[model samples]
Target: MRLLLVEDDTRLAEFLAQGLAEAGFVVDTVAEAGDAEAALDTVPYDLLILDLGLPDGDGMDLLARLRARGEMLPILVLTARGALADRVSGLNRGADDYVLKPCATEELVARAKALLRRPGGALGAVLILGNLRFDTLAMECAMENRPLDLSRRELAVLETLLRRAGRVVPKRVLEEKVYGFDDSVASNSIEVHISRLRRKLEAEGATVRVHTLRGIGYMLSEEK
Candidate 1:
């Protein structure tokens, strides 16, 4: 899943970013509310982990602005303010969940899972296409109950496609979601990943196909 982490503390931000990435999430982190707000304007994230104590502005303002714009994106408030009043205020301001600072990584992950399982969030870790099943939590893909070995990037691409199954996901979106903003993506890099993923799925006897929509993008659908 893709997530935006808005925290100003450089040490905590780096630690969380690395930890979240290792936990099978693509995280883009910014140190200030302004950059976070700008990122929200462009990127489509599955969830937002926001810190109320931002350097430039209060994270609550950003959350309120997002809600005012009618964006129902799932947001989790992660901050040091653990008082009952602070938690109540955060939820009242549109946060889906609130986690106190110095929280366990596992607890944070659990909360994220709970939020994503909500009605409108992305599908749970398991993605199904015909007889094929890809489990994001396990980082494994199975075809008809037989496990198919896949590399990390291959799994990432397939996960992206399967999450938005039947919808055309543009190459740029895939690049951003998979590699994040820091990596230098080549012109045909996405194509390479897509091609590799296609071969793996075909070899595994998956009944779904990844279709390229020419100049538009790619989609995953059951093979006819």
Candidate 2:
């Protein structure tokens, strides 16, 4: 899933980004609250990892604004504050969860998974398109009763398509979903991945179709 991490500490941001990436998350790191806003406006992220202290402003204000605007994005507060009032305040201010700094990476990842497993999040564990099924938590793709061998990028592409099956997913949207804001996506990167995914699905006897509309984008549909 795609996550936006708002952190001001360069070292902490880099460390968390690397760990989260290795854990199969598409993460974008922003050091300031204003940049975080811009990132949110540009990319559709599944969750937010927010540090309360930002360079431009308090992350609390951003959290409140997002909540006021009726955003249901799951937020995990990551900060150095670890007091009863601080924790309570963070929760009361609309954070889904809170984690103090100097904690283990595994614990942070576990909390993230817990949030994603919530009712309105990317949970229920799986998404289905025709004979193809994807286990979101496990990051597994299968056709009928057979497992398909797919690269991480291929899996990411499949997930994006399956999430919006039968609707045209814009190329730009796919790029943001597949690669982070800091990563450079080539002009034909998505097309190349989609082509490889199509072949893999067909090879595994999946009846799902990935259709490309010239100049538009792509759609996943089941063959009748």
1-224: candidate 2 lDDT, tens digit per residue: 89999999999999998888777789999999999889888877999999999989999899998899888899999999999999999899899999999878888888898999998886558899889889887788888868999887788888888888899999988887789977878899999999999898888888899999999999999999
Model 2 collision count: 0
Give me the runs in candidate 2 sitting further than 4 Å from their true place. none
How far is each candidate from the true structure, as Cα RMSD in Å? 1.8, 1.6
**Candidate 2, 112: how far from true, in Å?**
1.6
Stretches > 4 Å off in candidate 1: none
Residue-level lDDT tens digits of model 1 in 126-193: 78889988886767889988988776667778888888899999988788778776667789998998
Candidate whose lDDT is highest: 2
Whole-model lDDT values for every prediction:
0.86, 0.89
Backbone clash count for every predicted candidate, in the order shown: 0, 0
Looking at candidate 1, what is the lDDT of residue 191? 95
Residue 34 displacement (Å), model 2: 1.5
**Prediction 2 global C-alpha lDDT:** 0.89
